[model samples]
Target: MFLSFLYQYRQYLVLGVYVLISVAFMIAKSDRVNVNLKSAAISLISPLQKVVNNVSEASENFWNSIEELKKVKKELVRSREELEKLKGANIEIEELKKENERLKFTLENQKKIEFQTAYAEIIAKDPSNYYSSFIINKGKSQGIKINMPVIAYQGNQKGLVGKIIEVSAGSSKVLPVTGVGSFVGAMMADLRYTGIIKGMGKTSDHVVLEYINKDATINFGDLVVTSGQGGIFPKGIKIGIVLGFQKVKYGLFYKDIKVKPIIDFSQLEDVYVIFKQSEETFYQEGD
Candidate 1:
């Protein structure tokens, strides 16, 4: 009977204890106590909220900085690329200006000559390693024809380029005097020694002067010029300078002399074609 009474009153005892504690808290009625409790609770939770906010703000700031940095890097790369392109264009313009000045000088000087001169720009060059040939902008339509003499110059300093070998509607092919199949009737300006300048199959950037007299006073640095004997090239046009001389071992009549052409073939660009007024008559005869 006693144990049953204890179990039945157990729930009531717990409730009464809670009610007593609430009465005691109300009787205290101290403002300091209430304030202390609220302060403690706020202190604990405020730190947690502050920590969470700080973490979120830091993550947002980090991502924003990354995006901004990427944009800056991209702009910097583009600016550098543009600068390089401008530099290349500037270089090309400078080269073109220099070449134009050279062409103008040549034209001014050629005006004194009686023959008609036509200016043409070099357009293309052969890609073969064994041959030296180039194409010019003038053709048969411009009065250019086969066997026409090509002259290149820089400020009144004229040199032979080659002769027109093939002609088309608007362009012509030039066989340079240094080409393997090219020949020029040349003479030494100092000694008046005449010979045929022949290409040595294209190597070492040199040509051979054949049929030079063994007794000819050919020396290094002697200027060679076109003799105008074949009526192809004009008289007194510079060809090359003598670099060496070698007499044939068994032949006493002739000697071989090596010549270095005045015109730098590797850097050829614009040239002038000498179209004699006689070409019109020659072509009309064939028609």
Candidate 2:
């Protein structure tokens, strides 16, 4: 019976023995016993304290890294935004530069004109017949009128462009010299021979100079100009250069002459309208 009781209370007995040893040490008055007890207590707690410090250090480092990453991300976003702004500014600057170049070209050409003229920009074109007709930005409100001769300055030389046919309050329609219905009294620059220059439809690259005297000396590359014979185009305006001449199809008295216009109609952008002429210049014949 005593052995059975010992077995059941064996765990309790061991715990009581440990408690008694701890109390005995507490009650001891010897200096060496006290020192040994303090040493054992410090040894047991040292590893736990080290573990706690390591945990604290690791957590602090993790949080610090997170803060740095946030700062870096913010800076990256700011940099992207600034780059976009710079791109937009650069684009605007390029556009302004192109506008300035166009203005400079217009101003330089305007200086070469001698008559009372108005500067006008080409506002629109006939898609069906590009070189035949077009529209200008100036209109009757700006003193633009029908039959006002339009001319383009190119390569430091002035060339005949067309004339105003229709005028509105804010815009005017122009019939180019290449239009089928157009005609101008033209003369050769060197020979001083005069003829009527006629447009051979929109598709033709050269105008037809009709009623040339068969006996007149005709040459290729002869410069043609307005003769001021009709009451429309002013005299001395460059028209074209002679390309070739052919015998009239059915007549013996005239030559069918082709003249290449001086102005490149495809590249025309700005032009001057001859609103008024000098007093000394006059038309010799009715338009």
Candidate 2 per-residue lDDT over residues 245-287, each given as its tens digit: 7567886887878999999888998898887884423311111
Question: What does each candidate score in C-alpha RMSD?
Answer: 38.4, 41.4
User: How many angstroms is residue 246 displaced in model 1 relative to the true structure, after the best TM-score fit?
Assistant: 3.4
| Residue 173 in candidate 1, Cα distance off native in Å | 0.6
Off by more than 4 A, model 2: 1-108, 278-287
Give the Cα error of residue 130 in candidate 2, in Å. Answer: 8.3
Q: Alpha carbon lDDT of residue 68, candidate 1?
A: 85
My TM-score estimates for the predictions, one after another, are 0.59, 0.60
Candidate 1 segments whose C-alpha is farther than 4 A from its true place:
1-107, 110-114, 247-249, 277-287
Position 249, candidate 1: lDDT: 79
